[model samples]
Target: MDHNNMITKFDESKYLISMAPVEKVLEAGYYLNLNDQSNVLDLCCGYGEMLKLWGEAYGINGKGVDICDEFIKKGNERLEQSNLNHKIDLVCQDVKEFKTDEQYDVACLIGEVIFGDVSGTIQALDPFLKEGGKIVIGEPYYKQKDVPQALIEFEGDLLTLEGLYDTFKRSGYYVSYMAGCTDNEWERYISWSARRDLEWLRSHPKDKGFDNKEKWIDTWYKMYFNYRRPYEGWALFILEKI
Candidate 1:
C-alpha cells in the first residue's frame, strides 16, 4: 500500500470524521462558552471551514492555521465565498511554529489528536490560550477491543477520552464541556467514508486484506455504540487552564 495514495483516498473521511460539520462543532464550542461573540483560534484548521462557518452563520471571526498549503488555499477560497476574507485570517504554516500576537477567547482542534508525541501535542498549545480562555478538543473514544495495531504502530499514540481528560488535568487544565454523539446524524454527514476506505484498501493491497481492514472499520464503528464502545466515541471536551 502506497502511503501517499492511501492519504489521497482517505482525505475525504479524514475531512468527514475530522473536519466536516464544523458548523455544529463551532456551535458546540460557542454554546460551551455561552457566547455568540468571541475570538476563536482553530489550530490544525484544515481549509478554515470552521472559521468560515462561524463567520458566515454566526457573525464571529477568528484565525485558522494548518500545515498544508492546499488546505490553506481552499480555506482562503471558502472565506472569499463567505465574503469573510477580511474577517478571518488563514496561515499556511506549521501551527506549532506559528505565533499570534492576538489572544483568543476560545481555541479548538476539531480533528484527530494523539497523533505524533502525546505530551508534545498538549504542550504545543501552551502559548495559544488567553487567561480564562477555554480549549476545546474533539476526541474519538470507544469501548470493546477496537483499537487497531496499525493505528498504534503507524498513526500515533491512542488515548481514551478519560486518558485525555486526565492528561489535561495534569497539565493544569480542567474539563468543562464534553459532547457525545447522540443524534445518529454523524453518519448522515459522512457519506464519503466508504470511498475513503475503499481507496485505502486498493492502494494497500496485501495478503492480510479485508479481514484486518474490516476489523479496522468495525473498531471505529464500535466506538459509536455507547455501551459497547469505550467511553463513547466522538466526544468534545472543553478545558480551561488552571
Candidate 2:
C-alpha cells in the first residue's frame, strides 16, 4: 500500500500563480461560514485570486487591497465579466493607508503580508477583523529543523511550523486549520517563476541583471531543491480570533 499522501495536479493554471493549489484555496474558503452578507478583506491580494475563489465558492462579498495598479485593473476587469462584479471589488492602495470602519468577517494576508512576520501581520490585520473573525494567511515556514544559517538569514521573517503555531496562540488566535503546499505545487511555482524570469531576460537583453539572470535562476533552483524545498514550506493557515 502507498501510505504516502496523494497529490492532486490541476490541468489549468488560473490559481497556480501561488504555491497553494486550487483545492487548498477552496478548502481555505470553506473554513469560513460565509454568506452573501459576509465581508472578506484581502490585505495583499495578488490579482484577487483568493477573493474570486471565495466569492464564487462561498457567496462571499470581498474587497481586495493591492498596491499594484495592474493587479487591481485586471482583477476588476475580470470581476466585471461575471456576476461577481457587484460581489467583489479590488482597490489599488497601500494596505497601511487603507481606511475603513467596516470590520470584516474574514481578513486575508495571503502571499506576503506587508507588516512582516506572522505576529506582526496578525497585529496589523487585527483591527480590520470583527470579534472572533477568521484570518486566512498564505505564508512560508521552516518545515525542518537545522536550517542553514544562510537560509535562516534569507528567510528572516519565517519561523518553524511549531513556532508559527505557538506565535498564533500567543497572539490570542486559534489555529483552526492549515493546508500545506504540496511538493508538486512548489515545483509548479518554481517552474512558472523560471519561465517568467527567463522571458523577461529575453525581452530585455541589455538590462543590468540580464547577464546574471541565468546564474540567479540556477542558484535559485539549487537553493530550492537542495535546501528550501526540504527545509522550508508554504501553507494556507485558517486563524480565528480568540
Candidate 3:
C-alpha cells in the first residue's frame, strides 16, 4: 500500500494544505503591500491559491511551479474561470529544476521546507529575486526546544521559532512580520483533513487498492492528536533580504 498516495488522495479536496488559514494567507500578501507592478514567484505552489488570492486582492502578477499535474491543471482552470490567467501562470515542474532569467519582487516557499533543508532552499531561491525583494516561508517549528529526538527527526530537523529566525538571519534575511497558527486553526485544519479522508474512504469503499486508507487515516490522526498538536507549531515568516 502506497501511504503517500493515500495521503495525497486524502488532501485532493483541500485548497491550502498548510496550517495557515485563508485569513493568514491574505494577511501575508497584505503585509507585502503587493500591487499591480509586483511580480512574485511561488515555489512548490500547490493549487496556486495564494497566487490567486494575491492576484485578486492586490492585482499582482506571479508564476507558480509545482510538480503535481493535477494541482497545476486545476489551478489553471481556476485562474481561467476567475479571468486571472494573465496575472498568474501555473506550471507543472519540479521546483528544483525551475529556472527563470526574470527577477521577482517576492519569492515564496510556503509550507514546503520538508522537501529539503530550509536554509539551503532559501539560499537557492535568493538569486531569483531582485535586490531588497522579500521571501515568505511557511514552515513548522517545535513548540519547545526540548522536544523528543524522534519527533525532531520525523520533521526533518525542525527548528524552534528562535532557531528559525536565526537561520533566516544567517541566510542574509531579516524577519519582518511573523504569524503563528493558533491552536484552534491547527485543530480546524486537522479535523477537516480527517473528515475529507474519511469521506474519500466512504465513497470508495469497494476499491481494494485503497483498503489501507483507513489505517493510514487512523495512524495520521493519532500522530497529529498525540504528537504534533502537543509539541509542534506552524508559522508564516515574512523575510526581507538584508
lDDT of 3 by residue, 139-186 (tens): 888888887766666565788888998888888889988899998778
Colliding pairs, model 1: 1-204, 142-229, 142-230, 143-229, 143-230
User: Which tens-of-lDDT digit does each residue in 64-117 have in candidate 2?
Assistant: 998989778878876776579798989999998999999998998877747867
Expressed as tens digits, the lDDT of each residue in 18-85 for candidate 1 is: 52344456566466553447788888888776666667556676888888897889779767876888
Clashes of 3: 0
Top lDDT model: 3
Task: Write down the lDDT that model 1 would get.
Answer: 0.64
Per-model TM-score, in order, reads: 0.67, 0.89, 0.87
Candidate 3: where is the Cα deviation over 4 Å? Answer: 1-14, 199-209
- Order the candidate numbers by lDDT, best to worst: 3, 2, 1
Model 1, residue 40: distance off in Å is: 1.5
lDDT of model 2 at residue 58?
Answer: 84
Winning model by TM-score: 2
How many clashes does the backbone of model 2 have?
A: 0
What C-alpha lDDT do the candidate models reach, one value each? 0.64, 0.81, 0.84
